[model samples]
Target: MATSGRREVARRILRLTDGIEESHEVHEPVFDIKDTPIESLENAVNPLVPFLPDIRKHAVTAKKACKNPPPDGLTLDESASIRLYSMEWVPHDKCLYVVLNDTLRSEDGEKVKPWFLYLKLFRTAFERLPKQHLTELENYQRAVDIGMHSLPSNHPNFQQWKKALESAKEN
Candidate 1:
């Protein structure tokens, strides 16, 4: 069931970014190691460039919609469940991943999860994306520890990010 749901979500996401492509190659350090200097991290983690304004707008709206969802709209937990499952380049297999807070459960003690959507963005989107969303992507990466095992205890804004994750985990 979850697999089919994921496919549907992926289809929707692909439709949303249809026609977008990378205008140029993107170069950045691999996300396999931790403790890499932030200044030295040059590659844009999640290349969301071509869909810029719309993507950012969608993110902002999603954040708000998650916070105060309508009666028939997604709940906070539901929204958090809808996350970036994968963003990878076809040739190299490089990817950006998200870790979900999976504390939400159903009455039967099974995990009542949402779909995970995968998107393939153009490499050029990295260069064209707005700074705010870029920063947010970094935060998202940090939250999920995409490249590393865990976020550093002393990393700046760690508490705030943790709190945000906690809020999303709530029922």
Candidate 2:
């Protein structure tokens, strides 16, 4: 994946999960990613394979994208799959995310069946990713959680940010 594509995936993962431990999307009757077979990224998007008569070139572009994985430790092919999912071809509405998200949003569970293998691969890549850590905002939230239970309500530093704001207003 290119630098921009990896950055986008990182940003989306953080935005989607934020303080949550895991990011998830599930349909009715539950298609477990664990049960789905893991496959090469090219094979995973088999429906989009433009090998024979199909004319979609973006699929080929995605397949031809960098095979190296990002720092997250996903396979080279898995990274390619992520890149594919994020790419936009000439027609903005025809993007893979557009179609995949539509399938995800569908009321009918049957629509999602075709995407099982890709979903498994995508979720596997996600599993390898680190979440909501090290950044200043997440650091602050973590600090708050650490003391939130131990501090007494009457303590000077208890909800100290609120007190500090009120003090500033009076001054």
Candidate 3:
């Protein structure tokens, strides 16, 4: 597949996940890691280990899977960290992305402090990925198509994004 096609597929996959709403306005300053030094994935998300079960194991497994990888000029650790964040824990609520997304969207920005180190690694890793471009129309079409084919409508969360997208189209 072409680079843009791969990107659209990945975008559609992300859309299927429980992402934060785009309209949520933040009143507090965002924590960034522009000047922060890099750290191991374990150390980055260690603070969250107590709150999230099996996260350490998940990180270890993810790192092992990507040991020899070099995706888009990133270290193996960066690649594995991204993979770890994407991993789904047994309980849907315990998923790393789900929790992190919730923390990021919290009304009190202070709640996001614990995630600073992990966010720095996550965002930095994503930023280092190679560019992939596609038109908005193509992106939208692919999202719908992917949802229709990959996610059965009978699924509980299917209606969430499906209806939202339909409603958006009507407006």
Candidate 4:
């Protein structure tokens, strides 16, 4: 988990949740599938054993909280899971978000390690997004690409953006 990866995860989390509280301490260790060790769990580090379960727990909690939580009493874990889950129901992305949330909440300094795994999971999940969602995602991606481009020239993909912007402006 290099520093850049950790920051990417943070950026994605913010993009998915619109600025919610997140953890950056979940332990993520790579495993050799060929090696079978019963005690391997003991060596896990991202968020610790107890926090690993938080992903599922928070996911369920997020679903419930979406409909009926106090203004500021519930943890973002649940809400985050619910929204991400709703987006596509792709387990991999949801898993990344869950684990990432766990990492963000963690304090042990193992946050960067899970970056690759989380990104992999995100790709898997993103692949499952619906057609309608793909359009929306493309719109967002195009906006980001244009905003980040280094060249002085205007972005070539401006028609779709203009349509989207005009639609938004009309509303």
Candidate 5:
């Protein structure tokens, strides 16, 4: 049953990401790993990007929604390698069910370096989703606690380019 559920989730994710066109540039609002203080995008988003191409597609879909919803049957947890990531309820005692498709961004005739770097960025962005969402949730809670009923004016995530700056600091 878990396997079936995972497969269904993968199918839905695929459908969502399949909307991106090859001709147009998709403006994805990704957490800029370059400026993020983290050592590497890999450190920010591990297991999540295990299969790059797949995750890239989902990212495109996520961009459309402007939200980061975890894959079905998955739960966020602290992984030693990533500040925050998730482990799905894998059947047969496996740890993860999603496979990030890292190869989708590569050109048919392109060299390997760009593909490698892009995939790295993609993975980091994927991993950063949980952290960002958690931070947003925390910010929301903080706002509620203080009776503001809205994000604080100085809320860390409210500004443009905040992710890049934060990532740079971590680095």
Candidate 6:
């Protein structure tokens, strides 16, 4: 994998695991114009193409994690499948928090664990978002636009989330 790809995978893993006792070496961003031409950069940074590989890896890992029975000797229901229940956008974080239905349960009928999926809004596959989510994004952007324009310059909330939203939208 390219350095960017590796970084993306590491990022997803860290997010999923909440960085519990995890450490990753940080590397300076590289922009090798010579090695990676401008066209390649354009393609690499394309929102649709940039995150497919990372998302695929995440899907596979999540599948395996959910499919296997828990170590506590609990058996998963054969008919159970992970299902997305709802998604909420966190404008401050520039990410979507996906809540999923329980896909596994103990033999005693207790829920095993709940899965939380985080999808970073910037530099990611927007197609992963449902039409309703896209509408939510539009609604949020409109609300921010209105707030930025209507709020007084010196108001504490003025331009608070505008900058972050603009930055994320750029990606």
* Model 1 regions lying over 4 Å from their true place: 1-29, 33-47, 68-171
Q: Is candidate 2 or candidate 3 better by lDDT?
A: 3
Q: How far does residue 130 in candidate 5 sit from its true spot (Å)?
A: 10
Model 1 lDDT tens row, 43-98: 22223323222333334443354445423243332332232223223221211221
Candidate 2 lDDT, 1-171, residue by residue in tens:
699898776555433333232223333653555678898765677754332222235556766775554555667766667677777554444567767765665556767777787788877865554443224434654556454555466644444554644453444
Error of 4 at 88 (Å): 17
Query: Candidate 4: where is the Cα deviation over 4 Å?
Result: 1-49, 52-57, 65-82, 85-127, 150-171
- The lDDT leader among the candidates is 3
lDDT pick, better of 4 and 5: 4
Cα-based lDDT at residue 69, candidate 5: 35
lDDT of 5 by residue, 56-126 (tens): 33333333433223352122221222221132332412222222222233333232333344344445555
Query: Residues 1-171, candidate 6, lDDT per residue (tens digit)?
Result: 599898766555434333223233333432212232222211222332232324333333333554455332222211011211121133312221221111211122222111111212111223232344445666866755453454465543334445655554555
Error of model 1, residue 66, in angstroms: 1.0
Better of 1 and 5 by lDDT: 5
Model 2, backbone clash pairs (residues 3+ apart or across chains), number: 0
Q: Which predicted model would earn the best TM-score?
A: 3
Off by over 4 Å in 3: 1-29, 132-141, 144-171
Off by more than 4 A, model 2: 1-30, 48-60, 67-69, 131-171
- For model 1, the run of ten residues with the poorest summed lDDT: 112-121
List of clashing residue pairs for candidate 3: none
In candidate 4, what residue range of length 10 has the lowest lDDT sum? 37-46
lDDT digits (tens) for residues 88-154 of candidate 4: 2334435544555455455444553434332333333344333444456567756565554552335
RMSD after CA superposition, every candidate? 18.4, 13.3, 9.7, 14.5, 17.5, 19.7
Of 5 and 6, the candidate ahead on lDDT is 5
What overall lDDT goes with each candidate model? Answer: 0.33, 0.58, 0.70, 0.42, 0.38, 0.32
lDDT of 3: 0.70
Cα-based TM-score, every candidate: 0.20, 0.53, 0.64, 0.28, 0.19, 0.21
